[model samples]
Target: MNKKSMSKGIIKDILIVAIGVLAIWIGLQVAFGTQNPFYVVASGSMIPVLQVYDVLIVQGHEPFEDIKVGDVIVFNRPSGQDRVIVHRVASIINDDPKIIRTQGDANPASIPGTDFPITKEEYIGKVAYVIPQIGYVTQILKPPMNYIIIVIVVGIMIVKQISKKKNDKGLNINDLFTKNNSEQTENHFSELDTLEKDKEYSTHVESKPLDEDNSKNNSDKEQK
Candidate 1:
């Protein structure tokens, strides 16, 4: 109802949403085996079909032999390289042990000079989805900007906690008033007892005079 209580509630709500999102992100990583959802095209191997910086969703596939011609696929650029290349399957030149020949859409011929053989294990996955200009944004969000955003969020949470502490101190004023009021009540009761004792002593002092006056009157009547 009060400002302090409202502020605390808002902070709790913000924390809940932030934590929920983080948990979802972690769960997706475990489910998919990747933290990032999209991959950026680094080369022109799939030009005309897919350009540089074009973001595409990569999903697990069965085998390269199962892929059909005209289907866009991504695989390692070259053996022993960590980079990936995206291209279309020109044709299934050989399928005995599952080998395929791939070529870029812009290129004049297929790869490997004479049908570059790609095995079943070489193919990464087919393109699930694509966004034209969003790949550049993903690249930017990858490095320093991600860390910067995390740091800023942590700082805001720390400041909120400090503010909550200050608000708690201000709200404790009511507790102090309650303690003082209880002490005052005890003091007033003690003073009331003292006043009762004083009244009793005054009554005792007047009682002796009345008794003496009564005795004098009785003696005078007896003398007459």
Candidate 2:
């Protein structure tokens, strides 16, 4: 392969992998109808049902009224707090505020006052699916660390691709070995052919001399 061909092949492989990753992320976001649908569970509040580092897929399409008791939901924390929580709906009071109580499956009682019976305005969404263990990847690669890791991985991939292209374009060790072996085999065959031709030519030269001597001796004997 030439330099241009090798580079194009490497680029094609990288693009394929990149597109696949983007497709999965986009498909998940579009299907859930939420821009940020995946959440990492830091605490084991949901216990055996949902372990720590489990990723939650929240879908915003379901109406607040449709949320029934025992259904787990993700909602914004009450009052000045700017955090979200995922818990099971324990009760639903159809009032002006439309109270929706929620509690963790592991907790003995419903989540403390003001947070549980969250209003429709506080509701973020309902838990549509649970992806186990992948949240740990998100948790490990957070913020600056995540960016650094991405840069390092991209750098490594670039270096690998460049090296592969070079190997394909230039005579690498494997190519050198194969080329040398082919030349050596051709040389060996040529040497054998040269030796065989030399032997045949020498035999023809020696037989012609012997035949001439025999013909001369026969002519002399016939004359006597």
Candidate 3:
């Protein structure tokens, strides 16, 4: 209820959420047998089949020897850019040492070094699943936007906390006001009842003296 306790509770909740997220990430990694079990499609190279920002769930457990033509795969670029690429297998150059070629679905032909000479070492995994457009969320979390999002979230939390504190204070004030009104009402009724009792007692006392004087006059008349 106090400021310090509220702050501590918020911090504890944040830690719990963070830990839960980390645990899920680790579980996915172990289940998929890959350090990076997920990858976001950054380019339209695999368009129509794999759009830009499509989320890919890669399974590293797939045997490299099982790869064949037309199968979509994720691999490190053989040459330039030194980045991951998602493309379909154009051909299997060799089976002995496991060499292959890949080409983007949108491209006319496979680029020489960029797509060819894919060895097992460069192979990451097969595309196990595709989640449409979800990678855009990851993209949005990328630099300046992530910072902006954090600020917005923190601001909302602070506003909610302040609002809740104000509501609690308001409720307490209302209870006190109601108690005072109730006490005042009860005291007013008690005073009215006391006044009524006093009025009745005074009327009885005044009527008694008149009755006694009347009795004495009547007795004298009778005697005369």
User: Which prediction has the highest TM-score against the true structure?
Assistant: 3
Sliding window of 10 residues with minimal summed lDDT for model 1? 168-177
Could you tell me every candidate's TM-score relative to the true structure?
0.48, 0.54, 0.62
1-224 in candidate 1: lDDT tens per residue?
99999999999998886776566455434433444434677655444436576666554433455687756676764455455666677778776876778766544345452225666656676664454444465456876545334334433433453477543322222232256567864564345423322222233333333367755865675689
How far is 40's C-alpha from truth in model 1 (Å)?
A: 0.6
Candidate 3 lDDT at 76 equals 88
TM-score of 2: 0.54
Per-model root-mean-square deviation over C-alphas: 42.7, 38.5, 40.6
Q: Compose the digit string of candidate 2's lDDT tens values, residues 92-114.
A: 76665588787665443454442
Give the poorly placed runs of model 1, Cα more than 4 Å off.
1-37, 113-115, 138-224
Over 4 Å off, model 3: 142-224
Which pairs, if any, clash in model 2? none
2 or 3, greater by lDDT: 3
For candidate 2, the per-residue lDDT at 183 reads: 84
Give the alpha carbon lDDT tens digit for every residue of 54-114 in model 3.
Answer: 6677779988999888678899888764788888898999989989998776554466666
CA lDDT of every candidate:
0.53, 0.61, 0.66
Better of 1 and 3 by lDDT: 3
Among all windows of 10 consecutive residues in model 3, the one with the lowest summed lDDT is: 193-202
